[model samples]
Target chain A: MRPSSAERASSGSFELFAWLFMRISGVILLGMAVFHLFYMHFVFGVERMNFNTIGARWQNPLWRVFDFFLLAFALFHGFNGLRVVLDDYLSQRPGWRVLAKTLVFVLVVGLMSIGGYVIFTFPAAANLAAVP
Target chain B: MKAHFKIKRFNPEKDREPHWEEYELEVEPTERVLDALQTIKWEQDGTLTLRRSCAHGICGSDAMVINGKNRLACKTLIKDLGSHITVEPLRGLPVIKDLIIDFTDFFAKYRSIKPYFINDEPPPDVERRQSPRQRARFDDTTKCILCGICTTACPVFWADSRYLGPAAIVQAHRFLFDSRDQGAEERLPVLSAHGGVWKCRTVFNCTDACPQGIDVTGAIAEVKKLLLFRKL
Candidate 1:
C-alpha cells in the first residue's frame, strides 16, 4: 500500500531467475562435465588426442551439439559465480560494481560467441593430421 | 569448580575501544554463565554491565558470543564451556556498553518484515481457528524471540548491513506459511528485493545460532521456494 512496498513489488524477477539459473545450470554442468571428462580422458585417452581425433568425433554432429551446450553452460555458470563474488566484494562501491558486472556480461557474450562458433562451424573433415 | 571469564568491556566515556577483562570465581558446573556475570557484578565489579531477564532461555535477552559462538548466557552452563569462558557482545552491532550492543538497526530490520498477523475479513463469532496441520506449517518460526543472535551470527549480515538478515526472514516465514495470513503478496516483494532473501548464501550459521533450535536456513529456503512457485 505504501510507496516503498509498491516499488519493491514492481521490482523485476532478474534476481529470482539468476538464483534459479545458478542451481539449474550447476546441476546440468556437473552432469555434462563429468560425462565429457570421463568420455574424453578415460575412454578416449590423452595419448591420441589431436586435432584429427577431435575432427573425427565432431563429424558425428552429436558431439558438436553436446560440446556446444557444455561450453555455454560452463561459461554461464562460472561467470555467474564470479558475478556473485564481485557482488560480495564490491558491495561498498555501487558504481564500480555496476561497471564490473557490465564488463563481465560483455566478456561472457564474447566468449560464448567465439566458443559457440568454433563448436558449430569447425571443419570435421580430415586435414593435415589424421590419427590413422 | 573455579571458572575464569574473559569478557569484552567498553565504555565510550572512559575507553577508546573495547578491552577484555578477566575474572576468576568459584562456580558450580551446573551454574549458568549469567550466574557468574551476576556474581561479578554484585561482588567483584559493580560496573560490569549486560542485558538479561527471565534468567532462562525464554527471554533471549542474554544472547552474546560465548566462546566464539552465539548463545544465551543464561542457557550456557559452566560445564559446557569448562573452567575458561570467553564472552563478547554480538558482532556487527555497535556496542553501547560492556556486553550490550545497539539493537536499533536490528529491530528496524525485524519491523520492516512486518511481523504479525494480517487478516482482514469479517470476524467469526467464535475465533479464527486453524487445523493442527495448518498450525504445524509455521511451527518452527513461531519460537523466535527477536534475540538478534541469528542475524548477528550470519556472515552475510556481518558483511553487508543491507541484507534483511536471517531472523527477519524467519519471521517472514512464520506469517507467510500461515494459512490465515494474506500478507505474503506484500512480504514476498520486500524479500525479493536487492537485500532480500536472495542474499542468503545458504550458510547455516543462523540455524546453528538459534537458541530455540529453529531451522533458520530451512525457513529461508522455504521462503525462496514460495517466492519461486508462490505455493506451499
Candidate 2:
C-alpha cells in the first residue's frame, strides 16, 4: 500500500511555517518600525538625544520593554529578509545555505543578547549620582 | 558589414522539434543585435518571433542569451561580438513562445517582497529630510531595470522557481538601505525565510551579466551583514 498524502504534507510544515512567519513578521515590523521612528526621531528630536538621555529612558521599566521589543523585531525582520534573498539565489547548494544561515543566526543572536542585557541591567540614576 | 545569426526556434502548435534557424544580414559594425534581428524579421524571415519594445535597454524588453551569456539585445553591439552570434530566450524561465518567457512568476516574486516604502504615518508636507550621503548608500541598487538576466543566470532560481531571485533581492536591498523607508524591520524576516536570502550561493554570474554593472553579490552580502549584525 502507498503512504497517505497527509503523511507527506505534514513533514513539510516546517517550510510552510517559515513562509507564514515571513508574512506575519513583515506585518508586525510594519507597525513596530513606525512606532520606533515616532519615539526616537519625532517624539524627542534627534539633537536632544545623548547617553544620559538614553540612560534615563533605560531606567524606566516601560522604556526597557520598548527597547526589548525594538531589538527583537528589528533583528528578526532583518534576518528573515536576508533569508528570503538567500533561498532565492542559493537553494542549489545545501552546504552553502547551511553555512550562510548559521552565520546569520549567530550574529543576530549575539546582537540581540547584548541589547537585551543592556536593557535589563541598566545602571540606576542613583549610581550615577553617587559616583560624584 | 555582413553578419551571421543563429536563433533557436520552437513552435509548439506547429513543430514537434526545436531547431536553430540561420540568417545572414548586412549591417554597420556599430549596429546593435536588435538591429540585425530586425533585418532578419523584415527581409529574410517573417516567421521569426521575438519580444521588444523600447529598443533601448531601459524597458528590459529584449533580454536574451547572446553568445552563451544573458544580455539585452538592444544594448549589445555587433562590433563587440564576432560576426557570428547565437540568440535564444533567457534560460530558467518558462518559454511562452520564441524569445518570450512567462514573466508571471517573476513579477509575483517581485511583488512578494512588498517592494515599496511603507510608512503608515502620513508624509510631511515638506520633503522628507535625508542627507545626500544617506541617498548615496542605496543608489547602486536602485538602477535595476527589472531585467531578468540576473534572475535567469542564478542557479538557485534555475532549480526552484519559488525562490525570489537576485533582481527582487536587489529591489529589496534598495528599500532596506533607504533612509526614508520604514519597513526594514518587517522586510527582513520575510526576506530571511526558507526561499529567501539564505539560498544565495554567490557564483557571481549575475554580476558579470548585469548590463548596468551593479554589484549584485555585494548587495546580497550587505543584506546578509545587516541581518546577521542587526545593524549596518
Q: What is the C-alpha RMSD of each candidate to the true structure, in Å?
A: 3.0, 15.8
Q: What is the lDDT of residue B83 in candidate 1?
A: 93
lDDT of 1 by residue, B1-232 (tens): 9899999999989999899999999999999999999999999999999999998789889999999999999998899989999999999888999999998888787878789898888789998899999999999999999899999999887877778899889999999999989887777777888678998998899998899999999999999998889621
User: Residue B54 error for model 1, in Å?
Assistant: 2.1
Docking tier of model 2: it is: incorrect
True contacts kept of each: 0.24, 0.10
Model 1 misplaced stretches (Cα beyond 4 Å): A1-11, A126-132
Candidate 2 residues lying further than 4 Å off, grouped into runs, are A1-132
How high is the lDDT of residue A128 in model 1?
Answer: 25
Pairing residues by index, what is the TM-score of model 1?
A: 0.92
Best by DockQ: 1
Tell me the TM-score of each prediction against the true structure.
0.92, 0.64
